[model samples]
Target: MPKSKVRKKTVYTPPSSDRTTTPVKLAGPTHPVYIAVMLGMMLIGLAWLVVNYLAGNSIPFMATLGPWNFLIGFSLIVIGLLMTMRWR
Candidate 1:
């Protein structure tokens, strides 16, 4: 009769002693024009809400013409200004 040998498995783990931390810094110009445009659009939206409330005209067309148009126009104007400035 032959005797059988049993083998044991070993688990490996990485050392956690070596660690590095780096601080992240964001880079970009804080454009005042963009802020102004956003504020203007918000004001326009507020005005539209006020006008709708006062007039009692619950027309869907006003939604498209009032705040929506202001947002689109404001966005376009801001983008155009940014492009002209060439801020990269």
Candidate 2:
């Protein structure tokens, strides 16, 4: 019986030596209205904190949330930051 020959496997690769990069087309909110909305949110968060500090019970909803004031405020700021990142 004839001896069987082993076959070598080759992996496929890109022809270009340089690494390929896909163009990232990020859709950013360039609309002035949208930017204003984000700014409003950030300002609202700040105002809420300040009001809670200066005038107690000024913001009824803040009391309802209890210690989450920081959470809410920071979340609003973070959202604004995210919007800024996407803003063109």
Candidate 3:
């Protein structure tokens, strides 16, 4: 087998410090209603799963949904978690 040739690495160049940048505006705190909705989604998802497990067969609509109930429940939770990324 032939040995591979070694290549020289390029030198790192520092950026020029002469560029002026505008100050970034800081975002205000998230609204109380937004927090409430985010928390509500997660709580609702948990409640949905609990209800599905506890009485899935008893509820007419829940019985019809069958396995889809799991999807709906998990989706709500994931959406709520995603919303938290923008909360600040």
TM-score top scorer: 3
**How displaced is residue 56 in candidate 1, in Å?**
5.9
RMSD of each: 9.6, 7.6, 7.5
Each prediction's total of clashing residue pairs, residues at least 3 apart in sequence or on different chains, is 0, 0, 0
> In model 3, what are the clashing residue pairs, if there are any?
none
Worst 10 residues of 1 by lDDT: 79-88
The better-scoring model by lDDT among 1 and 2 is: 2
Candidate 1 regions off by >4 Å? 1-17, 27-29, 56-88
**lDDT (Cα, tens digit) per residue for candidate 1, span 35-87:** 66655655565665556556524676765576565555556555555554544
Candidate order by lDDT, decreasing, is 3, 2, 1
In model 1, pairs of residues that clash are: none
* Residues 1-88 of candidate 3: C-alpha lDDT, one tens digit per residue: 9999999999999988999989999999999999999999999999999999999999999999999999999999998999999998
For model 1, what is the alpha-carbon lDDT of residue 59? 72
RMSD of 1: 9.6
Winner of 1 and 2 under TM-score: 2
Q: What's the lDDT for residue 21 in model 3?
A: 89
